[model samples]
Target: MLMRYVMSSLRISLLMMIVLGLGYNLLVTGFAQTVMPERANGSLILNDQAEVVGSRLIGQENRDQAFFQNRVSSIEYNGASGSPNYAPSNPDMLKRTSDAVKEWHTQNPDVQIGSLPLDLITNSGSGLDPHISPAAAEVQIPRISKLTGISPSKLKLLVNKHTEGRELGFLGEPAVNVLELNLELKSLMPE
Candidate 1:
């Protein structure tokens, strides 16, 4: 009689655990994440003979001299590389940012007037931020102009063109998506 009661209770508890576990995951992933709408429609990109190049929601990798660079990206555009976490005041973060500032300055000898953009040197907390502040984007104008043959004024216009103002006029900061700006540059640059 005692053994029978213990087995019955154990079976009941095991069944409840299985049901609740599946329910929790389904509610979070299936109902909440997948079913939700995203405001980011990826309105930026490039086309080489009509083939899509990159996503606006992802930061652009700095390589060629012609394009204005985006924020420092971790995982580097590889979806499989996974997201990077930012620990506030972490020593690693400090070291990385400090090193990047030096490297950027070393590479560009002409830029000498002001400090560098924080977003440009520091990785975004999510390691996935796709935009930079308008001011941050503006500082890169001179270098971009030198490479693309666009006037500084014209490059400023392009930066402004891609900048999105604060949400509802008060919620968020103005930002320029690098992917969109670069694609526009590709199309607008006089070949």
Candidate 2:
């Protein structure tokens, strides 16, 4: 009786390990690769030379005045990591937002302080959000146009072109992928 129980337990464990561990992973990977190859492979963004610049799924810190910036990052835009996950009540979070507002003011003296979007001042949950609210992108238009010598009309057109509507028309707010927008800007300027 004891020997039979041991054999049965070993058999079940082996079966489950094979099915849940190897089989499930392989099935998901195959499905992802077939259905969405670009995203399954990290949605890498390429440059003019066709070299990978970065991934569309991750954010980057762009402090240059010529480039559109993403949200303030808690992990400094490292996709392998996550945000500090600070609460709004935390004094550190308050300080960070306050400092960011000051920096934005210092950077764009012409843009009104009240006009700045909250998304631009706060870090996203993952600290790796590649997209920003359309309002956030719009707030930076004047500064980007002034620095890049791109016309406001043309920049607004570019912003519109890159703007993505809410998923299913009623889900999330409209957003613009900052990395894509900045890459397009680089292509236009080609520095």
Candidate 3:
């Protein structure tokens, strides 16, 4: 009777493992692939040549002056997704913020440091946020226009085109996807 009970327990454990681990995962994957294939596949953004450039979901580093810059990413936009979480008075945070401000001043001399958006000089909570507030994008327009020779009016139009509204109309603030914006900006540039 003890041998039979042990066998039954083993069988039940194996069945549960197969059902919950394997079967559940497969079902969710299949459902996701069928219902939202693009998202399930990482929402990859492809270029005109069909090359996989980047994902619409992850933020990436863009230091080229011609393109609008993304927010400071503590992880260097590696997509590992974390923040330093430094306190306001932390010396490391202070130094990092000071360095970022200095770099912004150097890069954007025409825009006053005070006028710069806070997001431009700070890392996002996730350190991989791809969207910047529209105000942040606007402040960089002059620099991008100067570098790329795109008219400020046209750049403004482009920014407007790429600006995404708040989720479901009120869940969050409106944001601009930097990757998508830069892709469109590239199209306007001469090869």
Tens digits of per-residue lDDT for model 1 on 74-105?
A: 66755534444657587887788778788778
TM-score of each: 0.70, 0.93, 0.97
lDDT of 2 by residue, 66-149 (tens): 889899988886556677788899999999999999999998898898989999999877888999998888888888988888
The residue ranges of model 2 lying beyond 4 angstroms of the native Cα positions read none
Q: TM-score of predicted model 1?
A: 0.70
Instruction: Score candidate 1 by lDDT.
Output: 0.75
lDDT of 3 at 34: 100
Q: Name the candidate, 2 or 3, with the larger lDDT value.
A: 3
Ranking by lDDT: 3, 2, 1
Clashing pairs in 2: none
- Higher-ranked by lDDT: 1 or 3: 3
Q: Highest lDDT, which number?
A: 3
